[model samples]
Target chain A: MDHKEFIRGGTALSEDEIKSGKIFVEEDALDCRYAWDTGVAIGRYLAELKKGKIIAKKTNCCDRIMIPPRMFCELCYRPSGAWTYVQDTGVVNTFSISNIYYDASRVPSGEPNPMPAVIEIDGASKGMGIMHLLGEVKPEDVKIGMKVKAVWKPESERTGSITDIEYFKPY
Target chain B: MRKVAVVGAGMTKFARRALETPKELSYQASKAALDSAGMKLKDIDCVAHGSAPDAFDGIHQKGEYLADGCGGWNKPTMRVFVGGATGVHAIAHGWYHVASGLADTCLVVCEEKMSSAMPHAQAFFLTIFDAITERALGLNLIWIFALEMKRYMERYGYTKEDMALSAMKNKNQGLKHPASQFYGGNELTVEDILNSEVMASPVSRLDVSPVSDGAAAIVLASERTARRLTDKPVWIEGVGWCLDTAYWATRDLYYPRYTEIAARKAYKMAGIREPHKEINIAEPYDPFGYKQLHHMEGLLLSPKGKTVELLRDGHFDMDGNLPMCPSGGLLGVGNPIAAAGTLKLCELFWQLRGEAGERQVPGNPRLGVAQAWGDLMQVSSVVVMGINNA
Candidate 1:
């Protein structure tokens, strides 16, 4: 009388079973590419990075300053105000020293551990931040409210992208 | 609004990698649900479909590609997407279709094919981040989840073991579910979950739901049509959905305010003021072990920062005060994204009708709530169902 018994369907395929050549399987990769527009806010923000400066938008609503800058304020449904430069220093809102990579594979023991954090930038609206890597400090030393500064690539090597600032380090 | 009730539900076995194509998975689950309702495709008035990102399935215009498989052919076929919340939102859309005089019957279907995303589903998620700011930061999906989990534990002083018990609970619950990925022969303890490989300090490998390929389907009809189809119809008392800002960083990671707002909307419509007592059973989205606790608090079923204590007291057990995830949830049932949410609705349908058999809870439960959260940790969809229309 169990509903589970009457319930049915779905063919589970183990790796070995899939490779056993019993089922006719056709494999194809999703070959696709995209050119994502940086938009007026992000495009200008990225360009400012080459000059070794961080820029943010001061929205008309509540005078909220935002990074990863948007041309409009999401909450108030209005156009953002003037763009303003922000300090590169920030506080780590939250962070994690992860041993897993994007591919779901464990990091090799010898590889450097990745410490990713949401750094609440100074001069931006409260709790408004962008995610980035942490460096120049031991994983155990990273604190929630830790003050950090951007470690930028040499000016000549700047690429007008987020990578222009290599990582954030404890101030 | 008019009344709409769920007449039947169906699901495919949640598997790590289903050999069936996306269409085949949809067809199988759709067939089972239609058969359960004792109705044919012609009896359906319209179809509402849902699925996660096209990147996960490796197919563009997935809604169109999946239409025929879901019996949406030649009808007012439509797809509703809200990332992971697609499943529950599909039901909401179906309710709209039937409740607004558009149709007398509606079949809602949800599917996910994570196995087809070549390099890894996690890798595909990297592109989901802000291309200008986050994509270049070398982030995987684990970073954000771990960050949120860390913030939650830090705020509430919850330990790894505290969250691991949830994983253990759902794993145990899954044994009763026939379609569960961890259904039988695989029972785990709290220690096993704690000792497993840590993905990010607080989030262990076991805490994460398995990447699955499967589908789920449910049939909804207007009041008159539902009564004619089945004597024991589970009335869709209320449906609600909310989407918060995409700026997840600025949002509170310790609590999901979006889910609470969505739950409030549903509670108001269902005429239930006290959710912690009125609702008999609940299935909140649980892609991570901590999320079940997070969403429980979000649903107002348990007090904030205290769900862990209640969880430790066995309040969420199958026979406890409120049985949560009696269908094993995503942790044990296997998460195929969209299908997982729809399966939760199916759980409510079966449980409310007392047709769960051995998997049924001890109480003669009459009212239940199912919810799903998704899309940059910003959206939540909620549905309230009961034996009789409120």
Candidate 2:
């Protein structure tokens, strides 16, 4: 009979029984607002990343080139045809550094460890990439094929948002 | 295509916060899988339910709030998310409701609380990214397992002492598991997981998998209600699932093409054409220690660059020659993401019914496999069990 004595026994709760209100903690709040619609190929790729440009779409079934710019072609589901643009510079294709922070906490002893990567964007296709952030070197000198680029933020602090570029560095 | 079996199994203590309620951990793993299938929950006949996110139980339509604690009141129930392959796709949708004659007993369950997500449940895993391009790069979830363990240690040159020997052999087989949650009787090495704390750079902190709070269950039947409830029915021979493009950086983060196309559609529906020689125990979903050698080379059961020389030649220990994870899986039985894939299909139906006391595994095993993997590295879900007529 010992299937771990038929399971069930976990009642843990104590943070002073959820702050002394004697365990009745139900204070909601997740508006999770949205307006999203970046359609028509991520709305012309966020209006060509506020005109500093990056685009992509161009598809002919699956010769690649799709990027964060959609409007169809997830392997010839059709539509997507011409837009192109690309080179915000790329390579990295994998990187991490991180020292924790996105709520798993940690990162404070003299900061700078955020790294993040997956860059691969230059001229649209070969492994399409995008997850950003890698600023001005040294997380032991990056390198997963290095060569980075896209550090945007200027044109009157443009904001078509994906935080208007401001990151990928190394070049 | 009409067999289905796992007659019963259950779970719950893999804690790190579980003050019951997620419908009392789905009515204590669906009342210990309907009292280990001695049956009665009006002899079940359809339920399913497998959770993973309602943002870790801060509930919303969480399958109608976990349908009356999993017996799924008023019957014909359903709920089958695919992130962390929702408990083996809710036992492959209760093996398609008892292999399609539409239920002759089903059940299923699987829960998770993840301490009702607040400031830290890895902050709702940053809403599984890409909300406007990888959630604007604040990024979390151990930076995609430290960028897929540095593209699988730079395409198989391997190390981090070869992924801390799978977090020291799944936390030393989760110290003989009775529902382990990082089972602690000490041991852990490989220089204590290469001295622990690197949280994302070849990913450390003992290579991930913890955040838990659990529930797991199973029942399934048909084959004439599993030969009237049990004569050791582990059977559900095959089930598969796939998924792939969530554009997770346009693929190839060192292989797992949707766990080798869901292990070749469950080895072509279990006619089993050599899953590294007819599978014999494996629970592929480590929640990171190089995702158990990238799902043992995507469940073809170790090959692509030889799972770190067959995990440095112990060949996946727990008395080797193919015994991986032996229930100490989501790195020592805890990752409550869809009750850690139905606790690896209730530890392969108690290790194919010898009833896994002390996490069994010594070659009495008659074919097993459990796979889970999830979204943003894009889904996977396989199943395949055996012993009924073995």
Candidate 3:
């Protein structure tokens, strides 16, 4: 058992100073972990991305195409989905300010961070927004309908993961 | 269909950390509710349980694991989940058990042990996303709320300070609740909220509920059984629930239409013509401060993009024309996901019975509505309750 710090009479402390009290100490905490069974599919996708290729999937229902392939379309409920590729360019549809750094644990942790904008990729239609860090322009410099391009990592560092392309900046 | 009434409501001490096992926590609340209703386990014909996520408890098939504690043993029991909306959904499920004549009495329990999980509850939320698309992007749960809040602010011309008032108002109201954590009138200012830790852009730490460990249970009985038990039984007058598309990427995030649809159905069934003028009080799910305003608009208690103005005008306070979250809401009372919703139900029970005491609204409130939203914010469940409707 541990007793949290409570100041006595040494000096005055700001509320901000008192707020940082929980920054460090922790104990035997239980956490949940997930291991995907479909590792082979992920592995193959990474390999393709490393070769500098983009991927998509075609839903059998309306025959509409989707990126980052999937097995089923919850919307159409049709089975037997397959992979398709697309040209590697999309546009920013809508955006917003994210000044706080958050996750479940740390959000309640009472900390703070800079805000990032909600960016819609170029090729994606309206309402298909993905969260990625923004760079190359200030928050004031960013605007809706701004033309931005993905800043991909060096060829050798390309992986099938989202990190392959870093933050999107002014085109 | 038969009429249904809530005969009893019980809850564990709402806290930031509860050391008991989920089973133990479930037992504590379930037993209290049963005892309060002067009923035994044998009196329950069916059981309904709700837990927000197995990740919160670190157990899969959470319903089965917690079944025995909720008295589901060898009976017609089922677990219902709708993200954060599970608590109210459980109540709705229990209402059906008696309304459909499937059971004479139903035990509804909601429990969450967020403290049991480590690293952060934020990590578990990472999995709520699409593994390929959103998950790969390393999204936090608040990212959605922050983005939604930003959109709501933009659409309605609401300022960050306007949203902060919810935190101040709700937390202050919480001071009156015996089970509230941050009670004692520790007032909060908009500057205080803005200066507090930022969780996501435009969403501050103070603007959100704490990760809590608690449980709440309510007993729903058929009209006959309820009359036999007590004359002051709180009747479940109307119930409605809806789920929106799980694809968060495909819909307009500025407003939650699911909540509006659910509220409309409940209000209609309850014969409420104008919710704000008819209903005496409300408990809109407030896991996030801005959510209270967002859902206020969806519930039609206030006009679209006008809840912030209502809040600013002090129209939603305890002494306001229509008091809201008089139970402290999830923000001040602490949010254990499912249990938070049920606690709102309990608050309504007390309010309608004129037994809310110090935390109770000043007038004799005859009717109140409680709402909960969950599942990537795609589901809404509402329950309208009254003291004499039975």
- The candidates' DockQ values read 0.69, 0.24, 0.19
- Compute each candidate's TM-score over C-alphas: 0.97, 0.35, 0.85
Can you write out model 3's per-residue Cα lDDT over B1-390, one digit (the tens) per residue? Answer: 898999888777667765467788888888878877889999999999999888776677999999998999989999999889999999999899999998999999998888656656766887777676457666767787777777777777788888888877888777777666665757777788889966665778889888787888999999999999988898998999998876665567788899989999999888998998988899999988889888988888888977877887879988898898998989888898999999899889878877776787887888899999988879999999987633
The lDDT, on a scale of 0 to 1, for candidate 2 is 0.81
| TM-scores for chain A over all candidates | 0.92, 0.30, 0.62
Candidate 1: residue A75 Cα off by (Å): 1.5
lDDT of 2 by residue, B1-390 (tens): 588888888888878777777778888888887898888889887798888768766677788978998889898998888777888988988898778887788889888888777767887778778677677667877787788789888876887888888777887788778678555566687888888899778788877878878888888888877887677788888888888888787776888888888888888888998898788888888987778788888888887988888888888787888888888788776788888988888888888777788778876888888989887768889998989545
Give the per-residue lDDT of model 3 (tens digit) for A55-76.
6566778665644445666668
lDDT of 1 by residue, A69-144 (tens): 8888887889999989999999998899999887777899999888988899999988888888899999899988
For model 1 the TM-score comes to 0.97
- The DockQ for candidate 2, computed on C-alphas, is 0.24
For each candidate in the order shown, give its overall lDDT on alpha carbons: 0.89, 0.81, 0.77
Give lDDT for model 1.
Answer: 0.89
RMSD of each: 1.5, 21.9, 6.6
